[model samples]
Target: MNLVSKNWEYLKIVTDIPKDYWSTKNEVVLEKENLKLRRFKNKSKSSNNAVLILPPQAGHSSNICDYAPDQSLVRLLLSYGLQVYATDWQSARLNQADLSIEDHINLTDDAVEKIREETGLDSITLIGQCQGGWQASVYTSLYQDKISKLVVAASPIDFYAERDFMNDYVDDYPMEFFEWLVKLGGGVMKGDFILKGFKSYDPYQHYIKKYQDLWKMILEDDKEGIERYKRFYNWYEYTQDLPGKFYLEVVEKIFKKNGMINPGTIVINNTSVDLSNITCPLFLLAGEKDNITPPRQCLEMANHVGTPKENIVQVTTKGGHIGTLTGSSALKKHWPKVVEFIENYSQTA
Candidate 1:
């Protein structure tokens, strides 16, 4: 191809990225206004232990848990002789913008109950990723009896654990600034705007460096590399809107107030969320290089949880935020160990 043709192809590839879809097959066992409970279809029946995965709800689809055939967390759990289910959070519309953190917790509780009913288990293991990690922590705290084990991957339990970029960003801005952004979105926080802020954290990588790499791939006619790029961007580019109320609450109660680690700081349905209430076997996963949620943010959970020191396990992967959950090396090396921890606990439960 000529230079002009190649340039056009590059522009078209970036501009018209393909839509994202879930690679794994799942059936929606339960549906609510804010989320759906999906049970993954797998042939393996090695164990009947049910696991509920809570994917990050920060303006992205829950499909991140089942990103692709090989990179899927759900599939990995299925392979380990465990039944897996996940929460698919819906993007907030104007009507849904009144939902709050308490509402999400309630919805999550409902999902958990549904899983219990289907599996006929009194409790199941809970796994939360990214934002979902903290959410899972809160749920486990409040509903401790319903959880056999808790695993949080790249989740921030203590926002003040480290002086990271996200803490700086939240601290530097006034509350009104974020409130105004939500106002502009008509009570919904636009996912595209959240994505922009994330990209801005590493502008060179998101803007110039990636395109430069893509141009080089085009010049070399690296079909495989280009295809890989397309698949990743398809998932990355799609955004989901969050309720303005929920966003503000996350900023104030979770981030600014550092509520998860502190008891009585976050209250839901008249019940205060106390991290120490979580007495189940706990597994905390952190990405060694994850700047978004620093390792300290995740590892600090060990200090606050009621789980005995011997029952708590922490693993740090050599990848970044999203990579910790879906990267090839993390999936191969770190996640299997996490699964093993869950399996060991499941056998006893």
Candidate 2:
């Protein structure tokens, strides 16, 4: 096609992309003020095991867990015969701006109880991704008995494990600067503002390089590549506002204070979030190239958890932060092993 035709096609593809997407079919099993617990429909025979997925609450939709038919984490686990459920976190509105981190934790506990009640199992496997990972860790630490197995993928348990952009950015800025942004949003932290910080991590990639690649694809008439680009940005570009209190706590407790690594630093419901309380079989998944949460940030959990060294498993993939969770290679080569680990322990459940 001519240059004009290629440019028109590119514009059409970009404009036609949906605002959001979820590849798998699911129903809301439970809904709370802040989230909805969704249970995916599984066509295969179910197993004795059930797993709850906690998608990252970082300014984006929980649909990341079920990104697409070919790259969904939910579908992969379902293929392994385990029942799957995920927390669909809602964007914070003005009223929800006062919600705290403890609120989220309590909600997670309620979701866990609902899963147990439905499955008729005393304990179920819990898998948390990115921000959800630390939340899962705190919950497992508090209620170790509820979780038969725990997997924290690309989570930052030890915020000081590596000196990366996030750590530096939080350290360099005054707390007031962040607070001011939240104030501007009328109590909630606007998702677009948070997304700007993320994009600042690599402005060229988020701004220039992606568009350049799209243009190249348009020039080559690479329909498949254009489709992939459209799908990824449809999810990536969509943003979600967060409760001001919740956002501040995460920045202060988890990132600034390195709360998870330091026992009793983070407390919930009059209980301290001590990682040593988690004694179940633990699996830690990390991406070697993940600047957001480096491998050590995730792998270092083994040092703090009460689980025996023999019971702990750590797998490192070559992909970056988001890719580790949704990349095809990770889905094919690594996630199966994760599911197998859960299944092996499920025999005892």
Candidate 3:
């Protein structure tokens, strides 16, 4: 927090990973000017089938593979000899002020097509992590033929279930206050806004985590632990604002209106995306403790799919929101199972 400490703090944030931990030469693709695309591969020449990964909200290229550190899901996929490609969302700024849900869907579709062209593969599999799942669902509905198979992980589709934490927050919003934030931040959500939203669920939890980790860092003089803390802090403390229009639409459609699962009330580009439009084999992974997206919400999504209902598979992993992505279940159980499920299906398919 002091002069020397503060500058060192920034260095710690960027330096944790050793250079070798990252895969060499990720092929870059562009869905649009605003949406940056990159591919992570384990082999020089790869299979026709590759997993298109969409990271959780606020994630970037580093989320998929940390070359400096020997950890990440991309690493897991590479170890299995499978190819992985991920999307890197541009941070919100004044210029991207008019971005909407349609833009996301279109950009992703563009990315899919680009991947297909680059690999010369007629078909490709899809994996959506968290809100990325929502985007994937929309894209699949819009371009049903392009996607061969779909996997939605830790995703919430029901939108309006009373128990969902995010829905509840949206429902209680003072429209004026939320709108004020949009106007102030160029129609994007601030990182602090999301952090405060998370804190609302359990205010002291994050603080406690910092304190506990700080105590360990100080007592043991653990440079590695201290360094990791700084790196995560840079990401955690750095807030990216989201376009107001998209945020409003998300509230109007997915949260307040809860339109994704029910009626066609939530209009995207004058067309309603019925859940029935999803006819591809779908795999949904839900965290039993995920209040942000309770398991029931995702299950309802499977109910509306036009495909054989039996083709929809659900894996109930144990963890809360992000934990579902990175905790014991992710590192130990869920990630492995997820890879196997997708790989087996893609191979047999």
Candidate 4:
């Protein structure tokens, strides 16, 4: 009876989703036996900048949507005949809990190299978002000649800024706090941890929004609102747990101690990864309303790149962290500039 009831409810939810809720599918290219990349195609002109995109902390899979960066950036770039391919992140469980940040770096860098080798080009541009930005910056610092241009969107550069609340919230949470959390999560990161990141502003707003949306779904028999909620549930729930060793290193060294900002504080692959190595032209996009990672945090990125600060351009839009990529404002104002920035840098670099 319980199973039947659940099936009935799920069927009802599916029936309620609106006809226009779905977007176009992106081409999933099998880059490797273990890795699949999302290639956003644009047939027009050709440029030297073959973009090899990196995903967030989620780890490595190009499962990007056509409507989002995959489509939007692809369409825009295609007009100029530029090619774009995004790297998708995989889950820790499937890959085993063996990867560290260094492993992630190797995966990304190797992909960039392979793409260039296949394309018969000497270099490519790097577009990094969120944690991907941190990865890009680190890569630029280390492999300076590989990337001709760097575009970091909605990514936090300065951990010292009051951007990530978890940084401060966990600050004094006794070292035992992590131990308790690890046990509670049963040795893996849970959906709750990821969802909590969206609650720093008026913690109740999310719950209230969910409550209102559910009511709207029921009252109007709105299938779209229902399906959107369901898809969001899937993504929000699908979180990869960080390795205990990596988590300890990230929180203690990167977030709390600001090891990333401090030149000599961190080391990867036996080599010191420092921001000072990023001497190439850089473009930084920061959402003004982003509560998760503030603009102030992103503002400091230009200072470290070995290039003149004048080469760094910051476009501060008024959307939230994720909204900057998905919402209307980004399409109208932000993305155009990003495309142009890449175009100009591509020709000149």
Candidate 5:
């Protein structure tokens, strides 16, 4: 192809994903700042027993929990005859860069209260994925009565329990490194940079393997594989900003300080967050292949929550971080176990 044709093709390839791309699969019942609570249609008879799902707002779109019809956590819950609600965490903007951990926790608390009132259910099941797991755990610890069953999938509770290149990278740099990053982003940490940092986790995947696979797919005329790649790439490349305050707090408090494991060490909104305060039945899921938040980080919560051993269930599934929640094999193997636990603790009509 000529230079002009190639440039035109490149222009066509530059896809656009809106800021509100994380908008829910169902009805958006409430929206505030960078937080949105969504309610999905219920086909189950036990719709009264509502469950609220929170997706990680790290850098990618919140739609990771419900990426497609077949790969939807919401759909799986609906199939089990359970009412489902999710938090669509909107992207942080430059002006909102100062938003803090307290802000996110408060917003989540607001969503939980709203879900409770809207459904008229005294308590709802809370399920969180990755970063959402941290948010959900803190929320449940603060308001145990509002949540009947707590589920955290692929979340890191004990940051110090495991070490990886990413963790070491952060540790090698002083807090000033993050400060400089925030300043470079004009007070907000650009999602593109965050995505780049994540890509560095496995440079082979980002730098070489992905493009090579794409080229192979093109040569083989694998339309289906190419379409799947496009879909995942669309979501992956479309990143969002994070409040500098929130980002720093996560690094300082959660990662550097290792707050979650040490009970009563972390304080939020005038209350010390103790995992032991969480008395509700707990369900913790971990991915064996997840290097980001290893199984140990997630499963240790079982030992912390005040819930009895019988009330705490932990499952280690096969797949990496993202695949644990959305992988096809995970949907068949790991997810059903989660639903079963939720159903047992969940209230019914």
Candidate 6:
């Protein structure tokens, strides 16, 4: 086809890209400020050890865990016959710009309690990924008895770790810089800003390589590849605004001050958070190739949690940041290990 024809066809394909389509096999049990708890349909024989999946709220939708049937962590958990629950944090809006870290943690607490009351399970296993991982740790520490087991995947804990590029990047900016940036958004952090930051981590992949791949698919007329790319890319292209206060606080406390592990450094609702209070069976999953939150960052939490060393399991699997979380191959190998670990500690009434 001629250049004009090819360009027009490309425009048509791009315009026809389906809306951010994320299929959920679960039902929304609770909804609060863009945060909702979802439970799979087969609750007939729920396990005493229910699983709660929390995807990072850093711009991307929670659908990352439920990206597709084959790439879904939700499907994997359901297949094991375990009662599964997840947090679906909606996009932040201008009116919700003042939401803070405490707000998120508190809402999560509400979700957890609701899950317990409904399921009659005393405690549930918490699975946190990336940003959610740290949030889970904080919640588990403050409410130790509410959780039976803890799993954090590809999450950053030790912010001061020498090899952490994210930490270094955060250090490069002053807190005031972030404050001003948030101000530009009128108190809400623009999702595109966050997207730009993520893309900045790897300009080639976000800016150049993806389009090259798309062009190749177009040229080769690879229908399957085209469909797969569209499915993943549409969701990726969709960004969510973040409450400015929460965004800045995370940049300050988690990334700048490294308060998560340090006692007296972080507090929630007037109560101090101490990671040592977490005595539950802890499982830390990291990606060996994950530069975003290197294995060191994810594994170091095991040292802080008071769980016996014998109760802690750390696995460094394959893939980079997003790959570790959603990569089909990594999920196939790493998630089964997680299921096995949770089973070991599960208790039924």
Give the per-residue lDDT of model 3 (tens digit) for 1-349: 6544654564454545432123345666574645767787566434445778876554223353332234466667666776678877766677777788887777787888888887776767788877887778877876777887888877768765437667667768767767787776666766577777776787676768676767656566666776666655655555556666777677677666677776576556777887788887888888888877787777667877776766777888878766676554465677787767666654234
Residue lDDT tens for model 5, 12-120: 4636544344323588889998887888877445656788898997888888877767777878888888888888877787879889988999998889889878878
lDDT of 4 by residue, 90-205 (tens): 44452344456677677777778777766777777888877778888888888888887888877767777754665566585765676566556665444356556555445666
Q: Whose TM-score is higher: candidate 2's or candidate 6's?
A: 2
Q: Ten consecutive residues with minimal summed lDDT in candidate 6?
A: 15-24
Task: Output the number of the lDDT-best candidate.
Answer: 2
* Minimal lDDT window, size 10, model 5: 16-25
The best-first sequence of candidates by TM-score reads: 2, 1, 6, 5, 3, 4
TM-score per model over all chains: 0.95, 0.96, 0.85, 0.82, 0.92, 0.93
Best by TM-score: 2
Stretches of model 3 off by over 4 angstroms after superposition: 1-25, 44-46, 58-68, 346-349
Error of model 4, residue 90, in angstroms: 0.8
Give the Cα lDDT of each candidate. 0.89, 0.90, 0.68, 0.65, 0.82, 0.84
Residue 117 alpha-carbon offset, candidate 2, angstroms: 1.2
List, in order, the clash count of every candidate structure. Answer: 0, 0, 9, 14, 1, 1
Task: List candidate 1 stretches off by more than 4 Å.
Answer: 1-20, 346-349
List the pairs of residues colliding in candidate 2: none
Q: Which stretches of candidate 2 lie over 4 Å from their true place?
A: 1-7, 13-17, 346-349
Model 1 lowest lDDT segment of ten:
11-20
Q: Write the per-residue lDDT of candidate 2 for residues 1-349, one digit (tens) a residue.
A: 7874966556676746556567899999999988999998889946889999999999999999899889999999999788999999988889999899999999999999999999899999999999999999999999988999999999999888877899889999988988999999999999999899999889999999998888888777787887888787878788999999999999889998999989878899999999999999999999999989999999999999988888898999999999898889999999998998998854233
Candidate 1 lDDT tens digits, 160-255: 988688999999998899999999999999999999999999999999999999888877877777777887887788899999999999998899
